[model samples]
Target: MTQPTPDHHGIIYRRAALDEGYTDKQLTRRVDDATMTRIWSGAYVLNTGETRTPEELHRLTAIAAVTSSPDSGFALSHQSAGVLHGLSLLTPQLDRVHLSTGYATGARLEKRRHLHSGALDDADTVVVDGIRVTSLERTVVDIACSVGFAQALAAFDSALRNGADAAVIAEYLEGHKRGVGQARRALGHADAGAENAGESWGRAQLICAGLPTPRLQHEFYDDAGVFIARTDYDWLGKLAAEFDGMAKYQRHLADGETAFDAMRREKEREDALRRLGVMVIRWVWEDLRRNRVVPMVREWLDRLGIAA
Candidate 1:
């Protein structure tokens, strides 16, 4: 008998073949040849190679294998579902396998799988790569409803900018019999144009440190109406805040002829802002993470007479 082609999860057996004696010794031989990689006890892949991360490949395999289990009613949810449905921009950080199943099924996987039980309507779900997942709108709503507003806004912005359909998402929420109210409320507050994460973090730190919300991406003009410097975050009457991403600077410095030349150009940018009466307070990644941010930012704002 011809073997079934491996599913995305890498399972090679058909439903009817499970009763037949498929020895582990035979499977191990296939694995040795790199023809199949055993993901779980019973799951095997015929063609997936080592190019992809183990977690990613395992996630797909887990999703696929879950279907054959007694709890076949589960749908993919959260970030896993988002990734599968092409809604999430961030790659999976955890090896977590998220699945949603009916409460009646009472089926559960090991600790590696996170299971949610709910009555999901047809509109709230979509089939992705033969696995059911929460629809784009539902995924966004689920994230917004669970996370804080700022994070929700960031995720929502990324989703919209990456071509998530607002109407379709809204429709899915509307059609959701369960959690409709919560979803609608989150949708109302969803903003798809918040500043990037770095800018947002910098702004939050400044505010939390008693600095006023600076004008973001502000353009400065000379008395003659000529544009001078476009600052990342600027205060109207006195101060300016600049977030320097280390990676960005590293890339710029790498392209420069020498480290000193790159340093000179950076200093010049600061000097130009200073000449325009803008007292610049620069922050690097380390400052943001250390909680030393508030005191330093407060000191700078105080120097500019802009501290609250």
Candidate 2:
């Protein structure tokens, strides 16, 4: 194996490091020097950049898990499979990658890998990006089993948006009894209108709080037929919830405009919606992370008599 360049974004297994003539002491020295980052046990990152998301890093770790595995028969499954397949899901745990040996199994949790001993049918496995991964259907099923209903529903929604066939997923779900109830319930609730993880997280929080499912990607227009705005979530066409992420404002900049211009335009847009008799409620990432979004939105919905 060749040594990875400093800009390499892929996972580098321990064997690759050894083959590249990096001794154990040298590896530790590199880590101490901040030249290499160990994403998981025996898996080091040769590249360092700010653009990678948690999901992206977890996928690299999954690849590393595959490369470092002593067993030749293991396949990436569960959250690792979800990451590799590019299914949008929350990766709360980036320290480990989930793997399956595809045999009648034992559950093993190591420092860097979570192993599932359950055997997989040929139908559930597919090669993605030069590695074996659970099929989208199988991945969703595994996520539903592993991450609980709300989160799995979020991933399932993204998979569907990314072109996973809903019928096929349902068909695959037939024989899977584990977590079937939560899976089915989440299926009924999943919506592709969730454009990002924040929106999905917000929806899941509301659902968990026993709030009614809000309509997503709702568009509004003035009486004269002027398009006003599309909101993240809407209820009864009178109340709206917007995920006010900071990156969203950055997306507003054009060739000459500044961040201030973006903020001004956003406020004007909100004002226009207000003129159309719509009330917009906004929350940021902090609110979502602090678990205040559900309560805040619930307060609005309660006033509007919609969060039943």
Candidate 3:
């Protein structure tokens, strides 16, 4: 059995396969045998039986959507472009591949693609892995305009951290009139020090609830000037907040260290911070998702006599 080579984006176009001397019957047989999976019409990816992450699968589908589209005027946009740009999004809709054409053709949703029309200039687009996508700032602004405040805050934080020009994004926001107010608010609050969407969402909750803004990625040093730990959020040297996601432990795992080990290290760090007169509080992903962070933080703030 011969397997067809996919492109750089892991997409095997049927037209390219035909040009490579693969017959339709062979391709169909491979699909029947589950060796190849069709992501879009006339586009397939070799199914090696390895599980794909949601982002990875969505990116592949996005590539397939772009590959199968006859018109080249449209570029990957919105959440699709956000995926390509590596921006942290909150519960992004992966069911559709979002695209934007340069001209005003009006937005439409088809079988697998959501086509958006906007006035896109050359600077508004970039090529990622040979696929045309909206520029990072454009993608962030587009996302800010389309999604809610908290979700948009996450994207804006990520984009700023990724070196997207905040001024340009602000300029782009001025051009949009529909949801510019929310986008402006998010941009105003966006901080690059937020490491991920979880922290951004947490901060968003605090801000919307009229809580005092916390210093992000605040570092604590021991009495001897030794660096202790960096926290996700710090308020008035009285409280430090952490977003406790399992992925965080996994992401920061030291060499030869297990997740449990990472957690232990984190606990030790928290203890050190607490010894330095800082109250440490942590909330998990579920807490944030269920909107418990605000009240939890408020209680802590009230107990500590830190005015909200």
Output the number of the lDDT-best candidate. 3
Clashing pairs in 2: none
Give the Å shift of residue 227 in candidate 1: 6.8
Cα RMSD for candidates in order: 6.6, 3.2, 1.6
Model 2 C-alpha lDDT per residue in residues 125-228, reported as the tens digit of each score: 99988888888888887787667665777887887777787888777677677787788777777777888767888898888888878899988988888888
Identify the superior model by lDDT, candidate 1 or candidate 2: 2
Query: Per-residue CA lDDT of candidate 1, range 107-168, in tens?
Result: 46555777766667788788877777787767776665555444444456556755678887
Ranked candidates, highest TM-score first: 3, 2, 1
Please report, in order, the local distance difference test score of every candidate based on alpha carbons: 0.62, 0.78, 0.90
- Candidate with more favorable, higher lDDT: 2 or 3: 3
Q: How far is 250's C-alpha from truth in model 3 (Å)?
A: 3.4
Q: Mark the 10 consecutive residues where model 2 has the least summed lDDT.
A: 1-10
| Better TM-score candidate (1, 2) | 2
Error of 1 at 91 (Å): 11
Ranking of all candidate structures by their lDDT, best first = 3, 2, 1
